[model samples]
Each structure stands twice: as structure tokens, then as C-alpha cells.
Target: MKIDLDRSKEPSLREQICAGIAERIRSGLLQPGEQLPSVRQLAQDLGVSLMTAVQAYGLLEKRGLVESVQGRGTFVRERAIATEASGDPFGWQLAIGDYLPRASFWSQSAVRLPPEILDLATASIHHSLLPLPLLEASIQSALKQAPQSLGRYAPFQGDPEFLAVVAGYLQRQGLSLSTHQLIITNGTQQGIDLFARTFLGPNDVLAMEAPAFSGAIDAFRLSHGHIVPVPVDREGIRLEILEDLSLQMRIKAIYVVPTYQNPTGSVMSLQRRKALIDFAVAAGALILEDEPHRELTLADKGTGRLPPPLKALDPDGRVVYLKGFSKFLFPGLRLGVLAADGALYRRLLAAKSIVDLGSPLWLQKALVPFFQNPQLPRYIDRLNSILLQRSRQVADTLSRRLSPAIRWQRPQGGMHLWVTLPPFLDADSLLPEAHRRGIHFLPGSIFYPGEPESNHLRICWTNLADAELPGALECLCDVLNEAVR
Candidate 1:
């Protein structure tokens, strides 16, 4: 019953006491049906507060170690004792039961490929396009400036300097938001999870576009949300379909990628954006607006400027906006910003604190200099130009080589293209042969929540080197041609 307490440790006194007793229980030093000291006795013996002893016992009970009988004493639970004889070590895990959603497609998308394979599946700018030297320099600068940040924990919301930089950055993009309205996430993935956990519950309705970002689909589903798929066309998610859905059920939240949406590359028009805001306001549903590729505008003056984000029109704070830096900029940083206001913002902030406390302090500090640099906008402009050229090259190759039945819209700004194959061909069935030919792609079925459209597949033009893109596209086109023929 003797537990040594370390005063200078990071864990509190209560945590240390729990750990010490829990270890003893697990190691069979404290046997099943054994009655430990009472909370008052333990506090007196250990020279600690009675509250600390009570809290430690409470933690032990939570871990299924002990139980208290009425008017008696606290004794170890019979099932708490570890078995000395073991066969299958991991058999205990089976009792935990499975609650996670099916993530087969999402899992496969992250597999490592051979060097010879032309990777058109991952939606990231080519490594050469990223400012690696700048990133490295920023890291060194961060360490030199704030050496303690490496050893310190960041603020729950974000680093103040980084938050200030993000505020100005968002302001430049026409969204007037203060640092208080923002939470810096590990990435847009984390942002989606935070919002889902904060607002959604079991059987709560979450409306999302069919053929949406797979990550969002997985996140909401993991939260046990009953997802309703709305159709997306040239404009965006069909407003009429969403309105009808609102009538049928109380949707807790709507997730949309309005500008340069993933996989589809469809930008919600200005009119559609306004209607969507109005829909959310009327239905009393929150909108999760994911704008990952908004900054990478590939269109010039000929196609006209793209509309501002859905957040711009959301004066009522009905929208939780996520803007990702991983797509067009440095993916390795895994940096993104989440913007919300009032009560919802507080809820998301609390959820984020539970998730990871905060994103890495070192990375957050490193990003500040990068975001503050005057040349950042120039670098993005150059990156967009190259991506635009690559997109045209991909389009040209497809048009020249593929059958007329195959169709795709060249997106104005985005990392990937959503190409629809002929009805006779399924991207899933075609993927194995594609891999055999040293090419890789993401089949479109993975992007849907319910029944998926197997005829479509997403090809990211940003992954391959400029020199290698032509050959890769040629190889892909040949595969599609042979399939159709």
C-alpha cells in the first residue's frame, strides 16, 4: 500500500498515485477481492490531501479495477486480476467491438507506391513546387528566435502570433475575421473531425455532396452521423435537393466544398452560394464550408474572378469555415485554419483541446515567418501558373487520346480533375491494370457515402513532375482507350 510520490513530475499527485496503485494491481501484488486502504487512511499514510486519494480511487474504479460495497469497503473487482496463463495475447481486443466506419478506400489511398509508379492519386503539389528551402529556413529561424517553443506546449486555440498572421491572411482574401474566431488545426482533416464531434451525435443528419471529399465523408460517419447525400452539378450541391432534404429531416449540419471542390472541381456559383447561406439560416442548420483550394485560382481574366467563400455571405455565423494549406502549399506542415463565431466556436475549441491539446508548437511557430513573408503571395501565384499549365497538358492529352465517350471538365483552380469514364468501365476494375502499368489513381466510388459512382476517378495533376506528367497522362489515356475499345 506504500506509493512513492514525485513532487517535481509533470503528472499531478493524484495521477501518480493512480498509476502506482494501478501498476500494483496489474502485477498481482494487489490481488482480486483484496481490500485496499480507505481514502482517509491512504491520504493520512501518504501525507496527501483526502481529495487526491478519493480522486485516485475514482480513477481506479473507472479503469474497472475496484468496486465499493454498501456500508462495507472498497475491494478489487474479481475480473480486474490479470491471467498468468495466456494463449492469444490480443484476444481481449475482440471484446472492444467495432464502431469505426468502413474506410477501405481511404486506407488504400495512403499506401506507399513503388518509385517507378506515376503517382496521380495523392492530391498534393509536386515536391519540387513546394518551398522546401524556405520551410527549412523558417524552422531554423523559429528555433533561433524562440528556442523554448520546441519544449513548450502551444495555446489550445493556436499560437497568438500565428493566429494574428492567419487573421491578416484571411482578411486579404476578403473574409473579415478576428483571431478570436479562428482555431488552428493540424489540417482540414482535424477541423472536420472537430466540427463533427462538437455538433453531431448518433443518428444526427449530416448533409454532404455525393462524390465529396472522402476525408469529410469518413469523419462525419465516424461521428455516427446519418449522412444524406445531395447531388452536385456544374454549379455545386443542388439547392433544390438540399431544400427537399431539409423538409424531410432535421439536418444538424451541412458540409460543402464551395470553391474548387475536391474530386469534382466544381465551384459553387455566387447565386448558389447565397442560396446555400439562406438555406442554412432558415433550416437552423450549421454549414461546414471546406475551402481547401480557394487560393489556387488557375483561371485568368478570361473566365472571370471566382466568387468569395460561403463564409463571406454568412453574417449570422452559421458557417464553420475550414481553409487548408496542405493542397497548394506545404503539405508536410499539416496546417489549416478553422473559423467560426460565438457558441459554436467555443464548442469546437473545446473539442480541439481534447483531441491534441494543440497542433505542434514548433510547426506553428515555423509557419508564422512563412505566412508573414512578403513574397508568399508571389510564390503562390507562380505555383498556380505551373498547376494551370499542367492541367491544360492533362486536358489536351485526354482529349486527343481518350474516346469521345469519356468526359471531364477542366477545373479553373484545384489540385485534381474528376474524369467520368464510359458507363461500360468501372474505375475500381480498371485500377489493378492501371497499377500494373506503373500508374495509380483514386477511384471515385470512395468519395461517396451511400452507393457510389464507379465510373468516375480522380487524377491529381499536381503530384507528378512536369517532365514526367506527359508520359503519365499518355499511359493513363492509353489504358482508358484500350478499356473503351
Candidate 2:
């Protein structure tokens, strides 16, 4: 039995060791429950360092591919089947991230755009319009009134006044959460990470809307959650399939962007929201409600109006509200709030404390005066106007030019419009071409939990200026046409 490894290969010996063991498992040389060579023995056989072999074994164990029994040494376990199709895809191919790979690097990608090319990627608020001057003044004022406290770390939980504001904010949403029930996180991403770490374990089901927000899906995948794809149409998650799926799948948690959802601008209909609440109540699963972009929407637009959030309707405290400033507010400011059950907040705050003491006292305090102004919600009207005008320009250009080939919904409030291309094209395949033309749309496949190839794409309206909208849409239409034809 020989393991052929290229010494000069860029992947380190530890990674190579992981790949080697994983390959043998796929080829059936290492059968299920078959004992693996001892770490020391494998180190000697491979002529690599003991640390390298140990790291390799650790990788396999973390991946749920190998198990260690006290006296039995490491043995190949029935490879964790994250995907339960007809047979094991991990057992068959070297396909990376499709179904199985040597190592499950379900890596969350970072999207950072340069100042030159316009970024139509994330549904984020432009920093130039984010009231930075006001925030700076607030921070400086807080610093002046520090009372010898600003220099010290915040009391392990969070800033009191900020938490108070958060509590009040939720109360307005009809949540009635106390300050004790709120946990301040670095951003919405961190709140999501904390939730993912708390409840989900390897291969546990996380039900989500298809063409979902990729950021949340990536978080769940990183947390080792099994992603179950539920379809989403004009009115958020398809309730009929959900009604059927509830009986079959043991859903651990449902992650939803209920209002102005990423990619698709579909808001959950009042009826569907009720069905979801009822289903979750019956299923005994938590609802992770993401309402980051809730404040921005042209409700009076031609697409019509929608209803309130699931958390607003949650009576049993079954819904966990993940609210953040990343969308309508500043993302770089790194501020977000999570509202959970009182006990859960305590646990999560403790968990967060163990992670990083607490969020920056100054930044937390900076958001205070800004949120205090009664004009805050009213300011949303201005943002809606800008986004609405941009959407109109985008819509008209799309209707006049790309009407026949492309299909999309004129999103009532979101920065993005989820559009499906003609069947013959691939969103990912066409993205490189679009990128070359200084246009970027997120591929719909990554938004899918399972490895599903799709022809849909998310177009962010805010990134394009009113004048550039026509030319950009025409160029984009050309790209779509070329990709399909």
C-alpha cells in the first residue's frame, strides 16, 4: 500500500495527510470502522512530523470522517453523510464543495470592493450617506463625558444605554423585549455565528429559503449544519412545501430574511408568516429572523405592500431577532443587536464574553445619539426615495431593453432584484464576463444551501447611478443574451 504524494506540492504536509486519508476512504481501501494507522505510526510511515500527522487526524475527526476510541486508536467511521441522496457523493468523487470534497472547506467568502469599479454585490448602505458626521460628533461627545470609564472595558454584558435603545426599538416592533434579553454583537454576522455555534451540530438540519442570502447560508455551513433548501417565490418561503417538509425533516432552526430579503426582494406574506409561525410552534424549532434591511422599502410602489415580522407575532418567544446596522446603516461601524429569550441572552452574552470581552464601548455609545433622534425612522423615508428612484431607472431600462430575455420582479423595497436568466445560461459562468465589464451580480447557486446549479442572479440597484442605469442594463442584457444564445 503506497501513498504517492508530491513533496513540492503547495498544500502543507498536514493538508496532504488529510487528503491522503480521505482519498483512501473514497477508494474503499479504508473501510468503515477500519482502524487507521496510529498517529505516530502514520508519521513514521509518511516520514513527516508527528505534529503534521496529528493535525491531519484532527482534521478528519472534525470533518466527521474519522473517530477516536480510547484503546481502539482512530477508526474510519461511517463517513458523515451531510447530504442524504441515493448514495454517498463524498464516497465517489474529488469534487470540491459540490457534495463532498477531501476537506469540507465550506469557507465563507469575503466580498471587498475597490473604489474604482462599482460594486453591485452586497445590499449595503453607502457610507457616504450613512450620517458619519453625526456619528463622529456623538463619539467625541461620549469621549468628553467618559467619567473615567471610556478607557476601561465595558461590563461583560454590553453598554447599558445602547441596550436600552435596543430594547425600546424592539418594543416598537411589538417584540416587548427587555434590555436583559438583548445581546450586542460585533455585527449581524457575529450574531449569526453565535446562534449557529449555539444550537446547530454536525449534520443537523437548518431549513432556509432557496435563493437565500449566501452570507447566512455560509455561516450555517461553517457551523456544520445540514442545509435543507425550501423554495421561495413571490411571497417568501413557499408554505405549501414547508407544510409538507415539517412532517419529514427534523428542522433544528429556520433562518429567514422575512422583510426585503437578500437576492429576492420577496417579503413574507401575512398568511405565509402565520403558517411559518404555526409550523415552527408545532415543530419545536427556533426561528432565526433576520431583519437588517427592514427599515428600507418603497411600500407604496407598484409591487404592493407586505406585513410585519414573525418576531412581532411570536407569543412564545420562539423567534430570535437578529437586527443589525449593516444594511440601512454603516457596516464598517460593526454594530448589530440580537434579541433572544432572557435566559438565552444571558447564555449568549456569557458565550460572547468568552469570545471577546465585549464590543467597543465607544462605537456602542456612538450609535446612541443617532438612534435617539425621533427623526431617525423619518430619515428612512429619504433613503426609500433614493432607492426607489434608482429602482425605477433600473426597471425602465430593463423593461425596454431586456424584457424578452430576462425575467425579474420590480422589488418593492430591496437594494437587489433577483432575476432568472433563460435556461441555457449559468450565473457563475457568466459572472466573469460581467465582472470584466465592471458589473458584478452574486450567483444564485451560492445562495442555495444544497449544491444546485442555477441560472438566476441578484442585481443590486443602488450601485448604479441614475445616468449609468441604461448603459449598464444594456451591457448586462448583452451579457445575458450572449451567455444564453
Candidate 3:
């Protein structure tokens, strides 16, 4: 086996050599039980010291990738076998390195909890608040009108009718787009994955908000792109930092959740949106604008209309916009629209075809009438009313129950409240007690791409029933209070 070591690289010779061997084994280039070169031989081949070769092998052994017996050379370990006593029978699969990306933190946090536990971590609306009657009527009407959609596969781009509906819907929101520019995705997450597969390559620089969505972090990581985190404030991502970094290294794409940003519900100012577009044009970079929570506006009419989306401001077609309904509407519908143009649009459509043929034709058919329903806007307004009340209750409770050291700003929209703790307190360390008290929250570290800030957590105020909310808030506050004491 050949192990290439670059002395000029940041990794030490020992680490490079170790990683090379481990990759070879995982990729099946080195068969199980194959004998490895002797340490002296490896050193001589690679022109490294014998001590370095020994250290490399030691690291591989520690990783369970190799084993050495007395009076014999090192050999690759055989696949882990299941035994009656072992807890994990599928452990052997770990070494295969098939390389499917998993969002471990998101998966672990989203596990099914007991009925007694209040799920403050779930960023979804309560069932009672959903427009059940309206949705039922729409689905029944769709079944009567388009029964044949169930038998036929949807077009690779999307259902033509659904595309037309979504195009019109976006036009009302200030994003004028034609039917051909839109593709129906299963959800925004899938749209993000499509972008990653279509545009991102290894070592491509992706600049995103520091405390961004956890799922996006995982999706971008799957592309093996080097993510650069830019801090967010009341105005959204700090462009100055991104501009400075661009000078240091080429940034291929910028990802943002501009309006009603996830975790922290800050909106990017209109001027900032324009500036961002300008920057993208000047730098020749693409902007991936994710607007999943924009429609859940909780502010009063006095707050005026929200800023137009980044795509609305872009005349250069540099922005790829993704709008999802799963957050505020029917989550089971798993519906969203992605708008793009030019070569990137064609590539994304091709990627979607490979991903799932198309997002479910029947569901797309159901959404057409729902999108056209006259009562839809009123229903959204009603949802915001109840959500506003719940958000206020949460903010007021935190103000009264939490220490001044613990802080959070009342969000204008969206389900989550980004809470910051004193620097000495770590949110992850407090999670177990939070769970024991029958409440759950998402630790802030999951939202960050690298070197997370441990002093923050995200709590959603929308998932609990109105009656369960006060008690849930009390339980959450009690954990924080006790921790502070």
C-alpha cells in the first residue's frame, strides 16, 4: 500500500500517513486481514522516520482499523461480527465508509419523546392551530378533480399545474417568476441537498450564518465544502466579515435565511439585501436564499410589510430561492418550491430527477386548489394570531422567571427563540436536567458549523398546547434557575 505524505501541509506526516491507510481500508482498497508493510519498510518507502510509521500504525489500531499480534506484522482488522452479548450487531458497517451524510445532532434531538414530556425543541405549530377543515376540503376537491395523478409519475421538473400555482403565489410575494423557473421539492431540506449536489464540489467555500440551521450544516458538509461561518446580528449575516474572507479565499456561494431566520428570528434589512446582491454580482458568487419561516409573521400591522426576498432584489439571476410550507402549513404534505434560472436551474432539476423522480404527484395536485383557495390568507392570519399570543407568553415568562444573565430577544416571527446563557454555563450540560424536568430544547452547538458557542440554546414556543405552555415554561426556567444557583 502506498501512503503519500505532504510535509508542507498542515497535518503532520504521521497523521497524513494514518489517514491515507485508513481511507484505503475503508474504501476496500486494502482487503480485510491483509498484511501491512513493516514500519521500517513504510518509513523507507515514504522517506519518513521509523518512529513516524510506528505512530501512524498506532493511530490506525486505536481506530479499530488494524491489529498487531506478537511476533507478527500488523494486519487490517476483519469486519466486526455480531455476538449474542454485543449491544450493536451492525457495528461492522461503520468501517465500510459508504459516506452517507447524517445529521446526528438533529436526528438524536428529534427522537420520539414520551407523552408526558413537553417538546419545546420541535419547531412546528400545534395541531389545534392547523386549518384542518380547510385542508380536508381542499384534499377532497383535489381527489375528485385529478384522480389520474395517483397513477402517473410527475414530470421531472414538477407537476405543470403545481408549478403554475407556485409561480403565481410567489409573484404576489414580490418574487416574480415563471413556471419553468420553479421546481417542487419534497421540502426545503431536499432543495438544499439538490443545491449542494449540483453546485458544490470538494473544497468549495460556502459562507453561511454562524448560528444557522442544523440541517443545512449537515447538507453542506455532505458536499465536503469548506464552510466559513459569518456572525449574525439583528440585521442578519455580517457582510463585512464575508467580504474580508472573500479577499483571503474565493467564496463560491453564500447561504442565508434572511426573513424570520431560523433559531434567531432576525430579518435582513432591505438595504442589506440589496448590498448582498451587489456583493454577489461583484464577487461572481451565487446566493442560496432559504425562506422557510417568512410567512409566519407574528408582528402587528403597525410593523408594516416585511422586506422583499433577496431574489426579488436580484436582477442578475444570482440568487436561488427556496420557500417551504412545512414549517407553518401541513408538515406531512412535505411541500416546497425552488426558483432558479439559467444553467444552475437545469442542473438542479436534473439532480431532483435522480433524487426521487419527483416529490409525490398526488400531493402536488392537492396543493393546487389549496394555493388558490380564497380563505388561505385569512387562515394564515389566524395562525399568526394564536402564535403571537404564545410567543408573548414565552417572552413574558422568561423575563419574570430567568436571571438577568440569561437573555433572549422577542422574535417578530418564526417558532424559535434564541436564548443566550452566561458564558460560564454550557447549554449541552444543562440538557439532561431539562429533559428530566419534562421539557426539551435544542442546544445551540448543533446550529453552528464548527467550534460552536456552547452558551446558547433554542426553544420553540409553538409546539405545546396553550394549556401545557405555562407549566412547560416553568419547568424549563426551573432548570436554568437551579443551574445558575
Top-TM-score candidate index? 3
**lDDT (10s digit) by residue, model 1, range 1-485:** 45556566547899878866664554344557666788898898778999999999898889788887655567778854333323557645533434454554456565678899999898888889888877788889999998999899999999999999999999999899999999999999999999998889776899999889987877886786678899899898999999888888898899999998888899899999999998888899999999999888888647788898889999789999999889878787798999999999999999999999998888889988988888788888888788777778888888888889889888878887899988878887798788899899988877887666779999988888878899889889888888888
Clashing pairs in 3: none
What's the TM-score of every candidate structure?
0.80, 0.76, 0.85
Candidate 1 overall Cα lDDT vs. reference? 0.84
Q: Compose the digit string of candidate 3's lDDT tens values, residues 1-485.
A: 44434576657999878866764554345657766788998888779999999999999999888988656678889764222324557645533433333363456454678889899888888899888888888789879999998899999889999899889889988888999999999899999999998889776889999899988987886786768899999999999998999998898999999998887999999989999999999899999999999889989868799999999888878899999998989887888999999998999999999999998888888888988998889988888988888888998899999988788999989998999988999897898788788988888877887557879999998988889999999998999888887
**Candidate 3: Cα lDDT at 203:** 61
lDDT, residue 316, model 3:
79
Worst lDDT window (10 residues) for model 2? 96-105
Against the correct fold, how does model 3 do in TM-score? 0.85
Q: Model 1: residues >4 Å from true position, as ranges?
A: 1-96, 301-303
What C-alpha lDDT, on a 0 to 100 scale, does residue 260 get in candidate 3?
88
